[model samples]
Target: MQNRGWLVFTLGVVGTLLALIGIFTVMEGQGLIQPRTIGLIFFFGTVALYAVVGLMVSARKVSDYYVAGRDIPAFYNGMAGAANWMSAASVIGMAGTIYLLGYDGLAYIMGWTGGYVLLALLIAPYVRKMRAYTVPDFMATRYEGNVARSVSVFAALAMNIVYLIPQFMGVGMIASRFLGLPFAWGVFVALAVILLTTFSGGMRGVTWVSVAQYLILLVAYLVPLVILSVRLTGNPIPWLAYGKALEQIDAYEVVHGMTRYVQPFTNMSRLNTLGLIFCLMVGTVGLPHVLTRFYTVKSVRDSRISVGWCLLFIILVYISAPAKAALVRNDIYQNLVGTPINQLPAWMDTWGKQGLVKVNDINGDGVLQFNELTLHADMIVVGAPEIAGMPYTVSSLIGAGGMAAAVSTSLGLLMVLAAGVAHDIYKKMINPNASEGVVLFWSRAVLVIVAVLCALAALTRPALIVQMVAWAFSIAAASFFPAVFLGIWWRRANAQGAVAGMITGLVVTIGYIILSHFYKIQFFGILTINAGLFGVPANFLVTYIVSMLTAEPSKEVQELVTELRFPRATRLIGEEG
Candidate 1:
């Protein structure tokens, strides 16, 4: 009866939202609402909804705050997980990347999708079995020492903060473009909502809210693509119908004297592409924010099941990316290219004012050439409806969807950062006797501080959204992947070995990224994005060598590894230990 009621409520909310969107679209067509007003309503209306849900489900108990009382059903958990996983990079930057990079951008699709498979097969269920509150908690218990816990904490903070900055950048982009705020100020606007959603409900609030966000973002993403597809090829399904559009894009490139859109290895070296895919695959298993989602489910089996649902939801966005990219590119080629600068579409002026689209007319032709215009990767998805001459309401909805993607992921990353500091570091190491109230208080405190710091960093416009996210994946791959993987599979993996592995991997990967990205140091011709290629192997070697040289783990620790490998019952790993 309870489940049926919840189902009806969900359907009602979704139907109401769809009706509102339809009415708004009609209103915009009829000139009853201004474009700016529609954008504001769409963006803030969803944000207001998120705020309300956060307040309604705010966490009170420690368990609720950390793991959502371990009560999320598999289906909803999967929906929430999909929302949490599809950050701004996936939601906003991906289609833009495909538009810009052409064939090379498929690397992201392959890497991220394949990475989730690795997580599902090799990591999620085992992590759930451990039943630890945070990844560091699992490390400390598994390795029997604070050194391992502290190192894991550092890795989580480093990866998540790096990941978190791009999410804020996404928010800033959406707010600046849609809400008419300065980019820096826009970042803080999102910070307010993120803090409200996360500071109160913690994981519990984030989970339910993420389900709502997933629906909005998914709809916002697909609707524009489907409309564009039908307009271009008379097919409502973009994924299956975009092939002809791709051919048209290729022909346009040829006529414009540009590299073909389908040409592989034109933008990235083959080695770098493969290396990036490998790092992303391993990194998916290492990300603390993603692994924490599995901990919120009811059982290990549910955790595994949720991964399947997550992939289903995520792949819907992924498969549509190429279609969106191709159709948008075709639109630009057909409508904007060769037009006089002053005669270009209205979207050029709108996005140009925000510095997202630039036109130079380098050949003194007064007409825009493909080479003379530059489109920022972040703008492609959000600005697609405008580029295709769709209704203003469609573009407004895309802006709102982008906000949802950014907010949902931001909430998860914020929780991971807070738990790493407040739970793993403060309560466990500094003040083990602290009461739950004191701990929750500190968690909220850390959430604000970390969010403010990341927001400030986002104002600098560090890198493209996808590039920063890829860096996070690389860091996670290098530092956490080996430590966690070996700790679970190898009984001889002691605290000393785990600590050494994490430190070595983290130092090598970060050092390479800094040197290669800032100083132009060439490392076997590998791009900085693939720096994890060097770190993952180094960590594995160091860990293996160090573990072999050190005395083996005690019998109890060895037994725990055996139990993790072959669970005799549905008990927590801590209980068995």
Candidate 2:
């Protein structure tokens, strides 16, 4: 691990950067600078900061490009992991989902956090000890077959591309809404920022930039909650203020005849809640971007510590999310429920411009009835400052924070995709003797290509961003979790079994999702979101049944598994065969 000096220095740099942005924001509000310019400067300037750092720390060697030379300290890796884990879904969509579904949405929180616990206990140490550069690296070595590697690589790429679409699209959406830029410009900016930083530094660059992003996003997310909490309950701490705020909300609900917002399980079935939580938890363990972080640390012990820190940082954000949802829901009801449509707050009008908040009088009444107001799940975070009457400066900070969350995750997934192509596919299977420089060059090339492809996809304005994010998780859980778990723990697991299991899991999960999502066909009247439930069991059964029916693994494959079972006995890339 490096000295603690860098930690202190980095914090100082972040503090200075934020202080300058804050000052510029005030000046803009006071007519010293153009509002749009300040927004652009602050938002993209943060990206520039990351780009400079990434260029400075970027890898010259294949090892560094792939895994940051395996020298990242646990603390820094933890921060990076948190930033990676909390994608646009967590930052922008989580609060919105909670606001829409009330207690039922808490499943996302429980499942995501609980999955980290599972990661720490069941997965991280072994993967770190195995010392694989990519998820497929571990898969190929353990299963002792090129076929296993190819399947794992394809799954990683598919899941990652699906994941990246929403994040990049979020960048464009946030930029358009917050900076008054066109959506394409927003996406171009995101692509440029990602290419400049991640393409330059690779995993090393992503690691440090993610640490900076964690700071920006958390502060941006927490600031509005703190101010609103003080206004609602005379406390700045959001969690502490939630109970009192809920009381006020309940009373407001009674006055307005609102039931779904206050009642638990009113918006979704409890079975769906269980299903969502289960999928997200297992999905967390299965996610390549999250698991890849473990491979970047200095030691297996550091990897474990990194998970602990990840949970700590993630929990802080997760707990505050419910507070944001409750406060925003209450604020809207108390302030806008009975106001005349013509006299509503400017924030409502501005947000309405984006079609995020809809106000209509279904009964032909002039008053804005509670039932007449419709809030999209995203408005809770994006329009939060305006809802609370905060300054445009704070709103700008929130926009930047949203960008941080989106860009940080996009950078990580882009790396995963690039590595999947350049390292896993090209060098491993195509040119086993490829030079390190050639591999690094292809990795950088793929990074730019992916950014462009994802940008084009983002321009389609996919309505399924959040749903796709969940789909990514569910797919990852179904396809990778069982194979990975069995490969590490069960010696009888063979290449044939893994191949069958992964293919079955992917088909089952995707098949169920297509039928339910496109056709609304419920299985045996089960309308709940249990696609993962069907896929996961089928995976285990097929893998076990197929492996037993086929030949057992070679002695070398068994030896590799035994080696991975202990941290100290293993070396990096412990491929016995």
Candidate 3:
């Protein structure tokens, strides 16, 4: 009865908010509200809702802060996981990547989706059985010392800090473009809201808030997609109807002497494409923020069940992405490609003012050409509604969705970073006798400090959002994936091997990223984004050899691996505190 009542209340809140957004959208269309006014309303209104939920369910206990009391239902956990997985890169940059890279962008969809399969089948349930609060906590226990845990803490901080920058960048992009705020101010504004939402409830608050974010982002993404689909192909189903748009796009490409839209290996070599896919796939399983979702569920079974739910929720967005790319491309090719520079669509100028869309006439013909236009990949999805000439309300809704995606993922990443520092570093290593209150206070402090640092880094706009996210994935894949996989499966694995493997992976992957990206060094034709292809193999080989050389783990540790493999209603390893 209690669960049902909570469900009813959640539905009521979501329904009421959706209805309000719909009314405002119509009002904006009818000129009853200014676009800026509605944009502000959508942005702050959603943030305020998340803040209220956080405060209402604020975490008071250590367990609640770390793992949400381990009582979250599978379905909601799945929803939260999906929202957490759909970072700003997935929400704002994915469709834009599809737009810019054409068929090459499908590598991301395939890699990310395939990674979940690995998580569900091989990782999530076992990790849940371990009952560890953070991945570093699991490492410390599994490897039987602080050494492995401390190394994992370093890797977690590095990867998550890199990941956080892009999320802040997405928030800044939305605020600057939609709310008319300066980019730097926009990042800090969103940071303040994020800190407020996360500072109180920790994972407990973030879990429920993520569920809400998933709903908003999903609706915001699909509404404009369906509308554009109907406009272009007279079909409401974008996934099926987008083939018509693709046909038109292909013909336009042929006529304009551009690369075929459906063709692969145009921009990147085949080997680089395959390597990128591999990195993304393995990296998905290695991500601490994503894997932490499993820890919040009721049991190992719920953890497995939630993976299924997460994949289902994620597929809805992934499949629609190609259709959005096709439809938007078709619209641009048909309507905007050959227009006079002075007569270009108003949306072009709007996005141009933000430095997202650029047009240059190399021939000085005073007309736009396909070759002269450069649209930043991040702008494609956010600007799609305006590009389609949809109502300002639709564009505003996308901004809200973009913010939701950025904020939801940021919260999860922040939790991982804070927990890594507070639980793994401070309490476990620095001050083992510290009280619960002290640990929690430091956790909240770390959240603020880390967020501010990332926001400042985001102001530099270091790289494209998706590129930075891929770099994070590469780091995680190299450092965490092998250690966790070996720790769970191999009885011979010890603290020495795990630490050695993690260090090697981090060194190799980070080195490759720096050399290949900055110094333009080439290695087997693999792109910098897929540096994990080199690192994963190196880690696995080093770990296997090192474990064989080192003393085997204790008999007790072997028994723990057996327990993780065959789950039952047994007491978890770390539950006793």
Q: Per-model C-alpha lDDT, please?
A: 0.87, 0.84, 0.88
**Global Cα lDDT for candidate 2:** 0.84
Q: Write one digit per residue (lDDT tens) for candidate 2, span 128-210.
A: 88889999998998888689999998888778877898998888888776567898898887777777778678888888888
Error of 1 at 377 (Å): 1.2
Which candidate, 2 or 3, would have the higher lDDT against the true structure?
3
Candidate 3 — which pairs collide?
none
lDDT of 3: 0.88
Q: Where does candidate 3 stray beyond 4 Å?
A: 363-367, 569-577
* Worst 10-residue lDDT window, candidate 1: 568-577
| Clash count list over all predictions | 0, 1, 0
- Please write out the lDDT profile of model 1 over residues 1-577, one tens digit for every residue: 6456456746765776789789988888888988888888888889888988888888889889999999887878888888999999998889899898888889898988898888887888888888899999999988897889999999998998999999999888788877778888899898887887886688888887898898899889988888999887898988888888888888877876889989998888889878878988898888898899999988888888989998898999999998899888887888788899879888889889879899998999799988899999888888888787789889888888888999999998899889999999999999999999999989888889999999999999877778789889999999988888888878889887888889999999999989988899977899888889988999999988888899898888887777676433533445543
lDDT of 1 at 575: 56
lDDT of 1: 0.87
Q: Which window of ten consecutive residues has the lowest lDDT sum in model 3?
A: 568-577
